[model samples]
Target: MKTSLILGTALALIASAGMAEQITVMSWGGTYSQSQVEAYQKPFTTETGITVVSVDSDNPAIPIKAQVEAGNVTVDVVDIEYADAIRLCDEGLLEEIDPAILPRAPDGTPATDDFLPQGLSDCAVGSIVFSTVYAYDRTRFPDSPPRTIADFFDTGKFPGKRGLKKAPKALLEMALMGDGVPADQVYDLLSTAEGVDRAFAKLDTIKKDVVWWETGAQAPQLLADGEVVLSTAYNGRIFNAAVSEGRPFDMVWDGQVYEYNLFAIPKGAPNKDAALEYIAFATGTQRLADQAKWISYGPARKSSAPLVGLYQDGKTEMAPNMPTNPDNMKNALASSYDFWVDHESELTERFNAWLSAS
Candidate 1:
């Protein structure tokens, strides 16, 4: 009888172990993370019988480097910005994502040809295209609202605190744009010493009125709480706040800097095969399209565009709200991943110095 009981316990333990195949994915938290959960993680788990443990970070890129260097890898997959993906891959901290492993389109087009340009990189696969757009609370300015990024920096005219990311990435680009640099010439202007100085000088104009945010969640919260009347946020955050939570925020697409968030498997990741499999599955045509229903960020795949429709509310048409919408792109600038990859570290140092100056 004791042997029978022991045998039953052993069988149960083995079964539990088999069923517990797990992968931890670190992502920027809030609705963006929730979108991934709804569109990818949950579906991946259900289909692959793999448990996904979701983790949040102000920026996953920062911690991924630390984890890889320390050789104490806990995360299997991380969703990070494109520049970080490129930088990390260059630093030998991330695993290469072979384009061949990616799922192709239904028309039998190869993944390379199917994905948008720069969508598939050596170390990462582009997941979604998000943007940094300033949104103002309609209740704050019912009549004269900020119409452009220039207006966001005009404290005298706007007369309210503004929220911006603490990082230099999008802010510098927008600052240059607000200073009348053409969208096409933003990166070129930023490349020289003069261009860098111009961006910072422009930033100095409204630095005092700017409330800096470190996390994606903090942007909309600042606007909601009136800590900031206008906040530069990921388009999806403001969209979710306005659509889901019934906030009175409205977006300013002018001078918005759009960029991609990608999924990169870190070196020494515990479940490398499962992580790779998850990326392939998650970035597939259906999964990318599915993500749009949960978040307004456009999918990286061209095929997914037609599949995108109304938001979760079913009343608001999602097409017009996307960062990739043609109308939205009129005055927009793509955040230069190459520029950021080249300058991220130096810019971080410069920003810190400037932040500490006054």
Candidate 2:
């Protein structure tokens, strides 16, 4: 049923492109969405006169799948995590994007080589490299800080409520890593049911004191309000809280789950051609570099790294705080898109069951 619906949508979209006027892009809301709007949407609009309608979602991929399955596709392009990008492409919910459509670099390098290894796929193009990192309020843990993944689960040592996201993706990996599973071996161990149970068992230690956050802004807010002592959050969100807002928070880079965010065209889009054009223009070297001014996330294109400069505030250097920074990469684990693609549904069910259990 879903396959037929997706096929129908794709054919309809191909036929409607000439008639459709504007392209709608769905993205994770808040400051991150604002960055894409400033860097890509508006500039694309200015350059081609095609209106880029921006929409917000907790995660765009959810609705993209729903819409494609229902054969009621509305959004043209969506900014989604790498795992979902790969999963949806395999499910035939996205259009196959060609490498030839992407723009060449200023130095004449083709898009295929200029983009980092994680940036390109048959159905999507990555835009940024972001991470899930835990942070603590300095005011709460002044004498000793929560430095490692193990420290995040040590409620006896830390002695405060720990904040975590509601979803299972990174939290499970963090639990495994916190239990002394080597960063490189987290996914391998998690491939089995015993590993899944082990992760939940580790989380059980802190479950009573855990405050779950659903949005990127909520983690930092939880710390600032004295609600949680340690909270896992995007590195950029913590950076904004600690640096931009003058908060006393510090990011814990150990056991971080770094991942890519890709821009993919849904299977049946209202403006298919315009969506392709938008992706090509937005992922260019200058445009991707421009996105970093609004957020600390590293651009997907390697050529854009040299072009990245100061933050919007003009004083802060964006490189030092990026998740891709050399200093932060030592203990980081690249979130396995393949692992989640194969295990997401099953693990998510188990995670929810664990969440509701006594």
Each prediction's whole-model lDDT (CA): 0.91, 0.91
lDDT, candidate 2, 277-314, per-residue tens: 99999999999999999898999998998899999898
Mark the 10 consecutive residues where model 1 has the least summed lDDT.
15-24
Please list the Cα RMSD from the true structure of every candidate, rounded to 1 decimal place: 2.8, 6.4
TM-score of each: 0.93, 0.91
How big is the positional error of residue 215 in model 2, measured in Å on the Cα after superposition?
2.1
Candidate 1 per-residue C-alpha lDDT over 1-358 given as tens digits, one digit per residue, 9 for 90 to 100:
9999999999999986774489999998889999999999998999999989999998899999999999999999999988888889999999998899999887788889888776889999998999999999998888887888788888888898889899899899999999989899999989999999999999898888888898888999999999998889999999999999999989999999998989999999988999999999999998999998988999999888888888888888888999999999988998887888789889889989999988
* Candidate 1 clashing pairs, residues 3+ apart or interchain: none
Provide the lowest-lDDT 10-residue window in model 2: 14-23
